[model samples]
Every structure is written in C-alpha cells, then in structure tokens.
Target: MPSAAARPWRARWRIEASPVQVLAALLVLAFLLAFLVVPVGRVFVVAFTGAEGGFTLVHFGDFFRTSLFIESFWNSLYVAAMSVVVASLIAVPLAVILARHRFPGAALITTLGVLPLVMPPFVGAVAMQLVFGRNGTVNLLLMDWFGFRIPLMEGLNGVIFVQALHYFPFILMNLTASLSNIDVAMEEAGQNLGAKGFTLLRTIVLPLALPGYLAGASLVFVKVFDDLATPLLLNVTNMLAPQAYLRVTSVGLGDPMGYVISVILVVVSVIAMAGAALILRGRDFATQQRGGGGLARRPLSPLGKALAWSFVIPVLLLVLAPHVGILLLSLATVWSFSPLPDGFTLAHYATVLRETPQFLTNTLLYCGLAGAIDVVIGVVIAWLVLRTKLPGRKLLDLMAMSALAVPGLVLGIGILRTYFDVKMPDGASLATSWIMLTIVYAVRRLPYALRAATAALQQVHRSLEEAAENLGAGKTTTLTRIVVPLMAGGLAAAFVTSFATAAVELSATLVLATRDVDAPLSYGIYVFMQSAAGRGPGAALGVIAVLTVAVCTYAAHRIAERERSRRMREGRATA
Candidate 1:
C-alpha cells in the first residue's frame, strides 16, 4: 500500500481534472443532449420507423407527389429571395449614411430602423395589413382621392412588401457595423482623386461593405424562408412553412409532407449559411482596430438634400402607415365603408384586458425562464471559450455561432424530435410539456446572448480576470463577483431581448403548444385574427406585445446607463 502522502498524489493523478470543472462541463453537455440532440433525433425515428422495424422514405416520396407541397416550397424560395434583394438594397444605403455622417436625427433614425429587430416579424405583418389590406388605409385614401381602384397589396406582392419593410433594418445595421471599420481616409483619398458621388459610392463603399450586405442578406433569406405567419396572413398559399403546418394539422399528422418540408427548410438554411460564410469571411469590423474612427460630415447641397428626403419619405410613410392603421382600428368602433372609424371606443382594449389573462401570464413566465437560462448558459460558455485553454475551443465557438443559422422553426422541430418521448424513466411524456417549450426558447435564443456576452467579455481585459485569480479568489468567486457584475449590462440586455422575442414567437409555438395551454402571445394573436370578433382581440394582443418589448428595451437601456455610471465611479476611485 502507498503511504498517505503518496496516495493523495495518486488520487490526484487518477482524476482527469478537477471534479468541479469536469462536473460543470458534463452538466452542460448533458443539457445539450437532452434538450437539443435527442428531440431532433426523435423526428427522424418517428418519420421513418415502420411497424416491422424497417426504415423507408415514404414521407419524402409522398411529399414530392403533392403539387401543393412542391408549389409552396418554390413560393417560399421566391418570396424569401425577393426579401433578401430588397432588404440589401435599402439597408446598404442606410448603413452607408449612418457610418459616414453625423446627422441631427441619426440616433432616432437608427433606433427606428432597428425597432423591428426586437419586435416579431408578425407584428410587422399586422401593421402592414392595417395599411395595405383591401379596405386598408392606403387603399381607402387612394380610392377617395383618385376615384380609382388598384390592387397594390395582396397575395405574393403583399407578403414580399411586408417582409422587406420588416427586415431591411437588418441589412442597415450590419452594413453600418462593417463600414465603421473602413478607414474614412481611404474614401477621402478616392474623392481627392476626383471620384464623384455615385462613382465614389460604387468603387469605395460598395466593395468595402459587400461582406456586411452579404451577411445581412443571408440572414434575411433564412428568416423569410422559415417564416409562416406573413405568408399565411397575407393569403399567400405558395409558401413552405404554411404548407408544413397544413400537412400536420389539416391533412393528417401521419403524412410525411411535414418531414419533407422540414428537410427542404434544412437544406435551404444550410445553403444560406454557406453563402454567409463565404461572403462574410474576415469582414467583421467589431474585431478591427477601435480607435481613429472619426468621420467628417459634409453637408448635403439643396439638390442632394432633396434626393435624400425623397428616398427617406417613401420608406418612412410605408413603415408608419401600418401603425397608423392599427391605431385607427383600435379607436374606431367600425372600419368598413368609412374613411375613419364609425365611432371611437375603448371596448376592444377593455375586453382583451378581461380575457386572455392566462396567455399573458404564461407568456411572461416562459420568457422569463428562457431569458434566465440563456444568460446563464451564454455567460458560462463565453467564459469557458474565452478564459480557458480548452481542447475544443474552436468547435465550441462554431456551435455557439451555428444557432444563428438554425432558424427558430428548425430548432423547434429539433426540440420536438429529440424530446417527444423523453422521461425520467418513471413514465412521463416530455413532448407536450411546458418545460420543453421553455428549454427550446432558451437554446434557440442562446446565440444572441452568447454573442453579446462574448463581445462584452472581449471588451474587458483578460488581465483583470487573471489579476483576480492571482489574488487568491477561487474561480467561482472571481466569476460571480467580478466578471459577471462587469458584464451585467450585456447579460441583462441579452436576457431582456431574448425575453421580448420569446413572448412573441409563433410558428414553433404553434407546433408545441397544447389546447389547454395559453401558448405564446403570437399564438393568441393568430387565434384572434382567424375570425372577425377575434380581430379586435388580436389587435389588442398585438398592442400588448409591442408594449412588452418597449418596456424590455427601456429596462435594457436603464441597466446600461447604471453600469456606465458604476464603471465611471469605480475608475475615479481607483485613480
């Protein structure tokens, strides 16, 4: 037998690493497997496994045989592609202006442009419907003024219009992020060499911001392709998501049509991600040098100002018109055969307040849980990859980023597939569980929180972490007391943003929500919009969603301000 001292060293050698650290890693791995891997795996099994224990591709074959399925798939592709193109064109110019100029209303414009980022895509659809639908404000105004009828908003065109309006800001924000890194001196030098306005933009700005445009376009493509609500709401039958939903509910659950659509969606997402990877390589301005980024503003001439406003006004009107319509509808007792409401009433608002309390409560609970999970996972994963010398650091980084490419629908399907039959071995069905929805929301939103946390951690010097460790503070203590508090603003922002989104999420919720459950606010709105009486209730719920996001955004901003103040005070004290 070894001596006691020798036995202690032997025990230490037997361990691969610290039990605490190993346990932590194992916990994370197990969580991923249970929540993500298994759920997605079940989808394939349920789709293919026969009674005789054999596999078949009957589902895929059956799906291809249906013309409706094929038509919808192609329609989805067309609509999404158009959204991608339109978003890129509009966003690129806005990004250029935001990056190059310090205008009077820059902040306001940027905020408005990014408003949709935090809001659900369907909210934009609701807004657009109020403005562009038959008997909508725009059509009503046009009919009254010109005494002529024109079908500007309906079918595929209406879907595309709404999607473009909703997602253009994605392109703008990304392009702005990219252009901020390009040396202004380079553009000034080009101008010095006699390059005029259009030519200068074409040669200099376009080439530099191409990667950002591509990144933004890739994201838009993925979003529009996976989206179900906009197309369904706008009466576009030729779309992928709606077809999938129909196959599951209207056709039959046993039909392979749903699997086929899911497979097609996965393929499309992969292609879009590939395109993003190719176009966005080495073009991240966030990783570039931070200092020396002061853009000199050149005042636009009267003619140039006129041109700018011309571009700005149309989009502003398009964006605001929907909200105006919604506002009018909310106030008016009736909406048809009248330019304005027949009578003003608060009945809709009051009625919604009385009903749907369960939906509101459930939405808050699920979102809050999901947001907390995301913050915890995000911070832990970020700390592991950035602060440690791990074996699969690059792989971890890639996995975290991979969530960006995985659409919400894909993730939802994955969750359903993996956990449909999961239990504690005591006979429990995880398939219809609220816990599953909460987990799905958490992991689906993980990438957003992770990215924000990573950015915040990057801003903090590693030496500070090291300093804390060297001072004899344990890893947990250091992380909790120092790193976490310092990164609180980013963590809080991520949580609140994720919460806002979860509260309004739809397509996946439709698949997962049970009859007894209140479902999310999205489902509630969808149910309301399906009928005439429901429209008033739906609009009221939509307003609630908007208010929810507005509150969360305000909270995030306040947290950021508090953190800033705290940092400044600490800095002065140290000095």
Candidate 2:
C-alpha cells in the first residue's frame, strides 16, 4: 500500500485511466449500436414498412389474415404454455426433493439435472426420435407388452416433450437456488403453525420460490417460443419460429411477413421477461436471518427415500435416453426397422474426422473468439454498470440483455440484411464472413456472460476496490489485481457457457454461413441428418459436440461447487 506521500500525487488517478476507459466505453457503445440496435431496428423497419416505402401495418394484417400464420401463432403459444406446465411439474418436485432433503445420489442428481442444458434442443431432437419416436424404444416396448404405443414424438407433442425434458433444468436450477437461500426459521415456523407436507410447500416454500420459478418459467417460454431447431426437426411448422424460418427461407428475404414474425418474437420475449420483472420488482428476497444456517435438510425415512428414487429414476433414464441414442447411432452402420442396430462400425467417425476437419476447426475458431469477446465485454459491462458512474451505462445493460429478447433467426436476418452489402476495411463483403458470424455469436450469447459477470461483481465487496484506491492504486490496476482475479472463475464460467452454446448454435449459422465449409458442427449435423447414410456421421459429429460441451459443463459444475463450498465454509466460520 502506498503512503500519504503517494496519496496527494495519485489524487484523481481515475482521470489518468480515461483513455483506456473512454476507448472501451466507446467501443462497447459502437458495437451495441452497430450490431444490436441497428439490426433490430432494421427488422422493425422492414416489418412495418409498405412496398411503396411508407409506414403501414399491412404485413401484420396479412399475417393475421392468413390461416397458416394465425394457426402457427397459436400453436407456438400452446406449445410454450404446455412446456412450462410440464417442466414445472417435473422440476418442482425434484427441486423440493433436492432442497428439503439429503438423500442418496443427491450430487449425481444435480449433475444430471444440469446436463440437458449443454445439448441444443434441436440436436437432442434428432436423437430423441430414436428413443421416443413411433417405432422407437419406449413405443416398441409398449407395443410389444401392453399392445400400445404413445405418440410421444408426434407433431407439437414431440416438441413439447423434448422441450420439457431439456428445459426443466432451468426451473430446477432456479428453484434450488431460491430454496437454498430461504431461512430455516421460515420452514420451522410454518411447521410450528401446523403446516405439513404439500400444505407447507404450497404456502411457505412455493410462495417464496415463486419469483425464481417464474423467472425460469418465463425464460423457458421464450426459449421454446423462439427456438428454430426442435419444431423444424420434428416437422412441427405450425409454430411462430418455424414459420418465421420457413417463411424467410422458403419465400424470399424480401418478404415482410418473416420480419413481422421476427418483430413478434422480439415483442413476446420482451413482454415475457418484463412480466417476470414486474412480478419480482419491490419484492425483497433477502433472508430474514443473517449469516446463519439456511434451509435445513430433512432426513428421509427408508420408505420416503424409496419413493423419491422411484420418481427420480425414470425421469433420469428418460433424460439420458437422447444421449445414449446419439452414441449408438454414431457407431451403428445399419439401423433400420429393428429394435437394435444391425451392424456397428468406427468408419463413420473416421470419415467425418478425415473429410471435414473444418467443421471442428471452425467451431473452435468461432466459439473460442466469441467466448473471449463475450467475457471481455461482459466484464467491461459489469464494471461500467456496477462500479463506474458512466452515463448511459443503464442503457448498455439494457441493450446487452435485450439481445436475449432477439431470437437467433431474427439476429441472423438482421445481420444479413444490414451487413450483406457492406464492405470491411479491406473492401471484402461482410456477408457470410467468419467475422460477421463471430459477432453474432458474441452478441447472441452476451447476456449469459454479462449476467454471470454482474452477479459475481455484485458479490464482491466494494470496500476491497476502495482500499486499493486508498492505497494509491489507480482504477485499472485495482481492477486488474482485485476485481478480475475475484471474477476469473465466474468469467470463465461465462466463457464456457457461451462457447459451448455457440458451438451447437444452428439458426443463425444456417443463414450466415455462406458455404458448407464455413459452417460449424450444428449445421454439419443438420446437413448430415438429411441423408440416411449420413446419419452415422452426423451422430459421430454430435458425440464430439456433446463431449466438448460435457467437458466444459463439468468444469463449470466443479467450479461452482468449489465456490459454494468455500462460501459455506466462510459463512460457518463467521457464524
């Protein structure tokens, strides 16, 4: 720490870092304006403009007038709502079980719960066909034994099932976090007042966890609503996203109807998130007790444990089925109208690895740079919002998050429309370039990284930074030494999440990738899944994708677990 002699010389040291500060702030502002605001603004422009180049609502009117459009709109809403209900039903009980009790396989259960999030919904949809399709495993067994087969993978029902199974982890994560933070006194007091079983949970637990649950639910709804892969792959085009995709891809880029759908997606996303926000605003979630024991874990009786396992085991199997099917499909040389593969071979893996090294290399290049960009921007945005007094920082926060409101398809279209003709500094067309693709990835996944960074920053004591300043360190030095180090783990989590998600991103890539070689694993998988003989190679690529994502996810899980354990130890010592 510097002494008083250095203090006077170092006063207003913040101004000394203005160049770095100003440059970063300006860069972020430009990036947001250029990529996010401009493209979205273009969508609204095209969506609302008439053929004569004046403002009109004819596009929306046309959309509402069409039976297909109207049906797709309603179908989207129906599927999203059903997904939420089913996901909640599956998630709430498991969250309660995890939070309120200490049981066998608790740790394994948590790891499994988070696993689905790593796989893209559409990618999972492919393998899901093998496990839940009409002639798939479950239905085959049902047909053999019970003389019945459920339509698990039929139409929008299939979309909802996959969505529910894949997305329930959102609710599970939120509810578990909320439950862990609930004061033990609340539960004990409720019990003292004669509340028990579902009564206690409904009144005390659910009410408290409501905000987190709804937040998660809203996210699931938006995600399912805007998702392009699942509905398309399942042949369920009577949904808004699939409609938008089909409209834009099939008809022409000049059609205003697709932009209209994009506008609707953006609007619905904003409204959903805003509704969740409104419900949570001014509601204090702070635990009444300070630094004491949190929610108490109840020890389950033998029968209770058995019952819990009974509920959990089947769900776990259903969740794991897609991955198992993918692995089998990748290795199978011939899988047809049979219960099992007729033959297996390593040839598929070898073919993909040899024929298309670009798929893997492009993914690494694109996702790595995108992840790094996300982390840097995320840390900068978090600092600007929480640490600095920069003007318009709130708008920066808003814009970064609003990227989430924009679906991948819309953003991809926006990018194509806005940048297709534009030339780079070197006079190269921006369309379908790796740089453009990387920008999309970074912006699309920016919210996740920003949220993680902001949350981490909020946890750090402001006093720590102030001390460095008091000791005559400048803002940059202090941040580098204190804030960045403290936030490294969270920033890494943010990076991994962004990287893994972008690795499997398809909607945007589908539009932006000009050639097959420019495409990543997701587009390759989609292309391969188109052919019967290509399914093995596609599945092989998928396994590679899954393994890549799984490794990152497990690393993140370990980091989170270590952080939690450290915090618990600190809290215990303090108490």
Candidate 3:
C-alpha cells in the first residue's frame, strides 16, 4: 500500500537494519545458548533434580555425607585463599619496584616475570616439582647448611607455590597500571601533610591501588579454584575441580555429585568476578589529572640497589626455574630426588619426534581450525558491539566475557551432558567426534580473541571507514578493506594467542576427546607423566608445549612492537 518513494525509503531502512543483521543477531543468541547456557543449565538440572524429574537436594546431601567431598570443597577454598595471599605478597612489591623506581634490568625482569603465563600451569607444574620439591635445590641448600628442608612442595603448599608464582603477574599487571596512573598530586598533598615512607605507601598508595589489587586477586582465586591440572599433576587430588573430573569420568557421566561440583564451581567463579565488578560499581577511583611522565621514578642508591636485587633476584630465579628445569628435564637421562640430574641425553626428544606424530598433527589441525573460528567470531562480535546499531550486541559482549568464568572441566561436562546424543546431519554422534573437541577449544578460548579484537577495533579511527564509504564502497567492502587491514596485526596476535592457548588446553579436551587418537599434546603429556619411565617423554612433550606457546607469545610481542613503531611514525609524519 506504500507509494514508490516510501517503498524506496523502506527498502533502504530494511537494508540498513536488514534480515542479515537480524540473522547475525539470532546466530549469536543461538551460539551462546548452544555452547554456554544449555550446557550450564543442564548441569544445574542434573545436579538438583532427580531422574524422575522431581526437585531434590538429595545429591547435595549425598555429597556432604561423604567426608572426602567435604574435604575437597574446603581444600579448594583453602588453596584459593592462600594462593591469593601469597600471590599478593609477591606481586605488590614487584609492581611497586617496576612502577615507581628506575633500576638496571628492571624492564627485562618485568618481561621475564610475565613469561610464566605463556606456559600452562600444569605444564610448568612438572618443572616446579623438580625445582621446589623437598629434595630440590632450595631444600638441598637448607639440608646441607641447616639440616632442615622446608615443606614447600608438599600437599596444598605445593599448589600454593606454583599458583602464587604463576598468578602473581596477574596482580602485578593490574597493580602496575593502577600505580603508574595514580594522580601525583594525591601523593604530593599527603607528603606535604608530613606522612612519609611505608606509612605513606600503606595509607595513600595502596588504598588507591586496592581496586586493581582486588581485581587481580579475585581472578587468581577463581583460576586456582577452577584449575584441575595443576592439582592433579602435583598429586593434590582433594580439590573440587579434580574431584569433578574424577567423579564424572570414573563413576560415569550420570553421577549427580559431579554435576553438584560443576554448579558450585560455576557459582563461585561467577560470584568472584561479579563481586569484583560490584565493588567497583559505585567508587570513583579515576585520577583527575595524570601527569605526562606518569608516576615519579626514584633511582635506588648503591646499598638500596643491593637490597632491592637481594629480594628481586631470588624471586626471578624462582620464577624462571621452571623454564630451566623443564629444558634440563627433557634431556636428563635420570633425575629423581636429586639437586640435579645424574646424566643427560637427547633420547627423550628423539623418542617424541620419532613416535606419536599423531598428537603433533592433531594439535596443528585443531588449533589452526579453532584459531580461525575464534578470529572470525571475534571480529563479528567486535564489529557488532563497536560499529553496528544492532540489538543485543551488549548482551553478546557480556556473554563472551562470562565464558572466561566457566571452568573448562565444567564446560566439558556441560558439553557432554548437553550434546552427547546430538547427531550430525551425516548421522554421526557429535559427542564422539573430533569436531566436538574443536568446538570446545573455540568456545573456551574465545574470550581472549574477543578482547583483542575489541581493543584493536577501539584503536581504529572511524574516519577510515567513513572515508571508504565516502568513496562509494559498501559497509562490507569498507570493513573488509579499510578496517580489517588496519587490524591485521592485532587480529594475527589474537589468532596466535588463541592458537597457542588452545594448543595447551587439557581440562576440556580431556573430557571431549572421543579417543586417544584424537587427543592433543596436553593429554599425551599427562599420560606420559603417570609413569616413572615416562617422565622424560612427558618433559619433552611439555617442552614442546612451552616452545609452542613461547614462540607465539614472542611473535605477538614483536607484532605489537612493530605496530607501535608504525603508529609513532605515522603520527610524526602527520604532525
């Protein structure tokens, strides 16, 4: 009934807010439902509901009745709490030194301190056991010097050591940002009021940095609590995550107790992250004025330098010990309860290369596929949130971030629960195929990629897209040419990050892997490490994971550096 002119306008409106956009929005909704919500919902349903479809707390009752389950729940809580405390102690000083002082090798130390993150916690657990174990170097020194060895690598203490070292950088990264960006006038005003030294630091600086500290500490707590591999590797099995994996696998997927554990993990993770966000909601921690030079850097005196290094050197040595130990272990012929290996050989590496080429191949294929899917979805989500006027984009963004809070073991169980009976159009069960592993990898690693894409997109000037459109290009063409090219380096970095991380994902992969032949490098490494003779091969495999992640991490840094240099040159050229 519309006129021709009105029809044209309506057509344009339809194109602008078209079926394509609607389809895309629907796809996002469906994807989140299929991958995240349903699986998690299934877990809750199975956890609290009986097989007869009646609501009951019987599962939880059964779980509490078992002393081991109660022990595991508390053990998880204790480990997480201790990890936060120890990680804070280590991180606070390092962040203070790096952000507020100028010193030799400070830059290098900061970089190396973050390297532990590139290696998976479980992968490094192997090397950490060798270095920090009671019969290890520190103990060896103590035993010879004082005839006493610390229990650094025993029981829950062992989990705390690895997790603290591994996760302190999370706090360090956040605290560094906070300290560097803190308003200089606040400190100057406090100093003018006669406050000085540690008192000033305690009352003024740390209070201002508390938000960042809490943010990082909460993440550390959640991550440590959700982790299964580190505890399983360290032989500390009485934790919620490990128990979830064991009960579901050993007792079969129908176990209600496993689902109860999954729901608890999911709840705790969401609560921890939500609590952080809620605590920051009403506060205005923003600095009114940030100086050009950021925080003031004071140079250490000669004696002060010695004291600083005295604290820092031991930490650096302890942090980098895993890297050294893993490499040495890979080549060691025999190493057991010794300060150093008795002998060395290259046979382990040779063995890995000569046999089990399937794992290497599977890793390459799975990671590559997952990385591509991640980048594609990330770019779409980033564009929708940043560029489009589409509905539910904010919801899409929230869902993406929430994925990080889901423990991999829980996700895996959810996938199994939700899709075990799902059949492909080709009539194959999706739950029993390698495709399931790929899907799990993609979902699990999507957050990192999405964050990268969003950040990269934010850095891009809108005028470039406008200019392309001004030249008669469509939105798609403008995006494909102007935007994608500008974000290529960032997108590549995102892809590498996803790929490298997916390469080492064990928890979800362990559950989703239909068979051993489809298993990736992490499972292979875990299998090898279960036996005494297999330690050498396992170390070698762990080395491969380390190198895989390290190379990708190095490349991402290089790409970022080049992009920064290019931007600087462009700014200078324009100026």
By TM-score, is 1 or 3 better? 3
Model 1: per-residue Cα lDDT over 222-254, one tens digit each: 888988777777667678888777776576546
Show model 2 residue runs off by greater than 4 Å: 1-19, 280-287, 423-429, 456-486, 559-575
Runs of candidate 1 exceeding 4 Å displacement: 1-16, 44-58, 280-295, 393-397, 421-429, 459-472, 561-575
Tens digit of per-residue lDDT, candidate 2, span 271-345: 988999999899877669657766889899999998999999988997898888888999998877666788899
List ranges where model 3 is wrong by over 4 Å.
1-16, 423-429
Clashes of 1: 5
lDDT of each: 0.73, 0.88, 0.87
The most accurate candidate by lDDT is: 2
Q: What is the TM-score of each predicted model, taking all chains together?
A: 0.89, 0.91, 0.94
Q: Point out the worst 10-residue segment of candidate 1 by lDDT.
A: 285-294
Q: For every model in order, what is the number of clashing pairs?
A: 5, 0, 0
What is candidate 1's TM-score against the reference? 0.89
Model 1 pairs in collision: 38-418, 39-417, 39-418, 39-419, 40-418
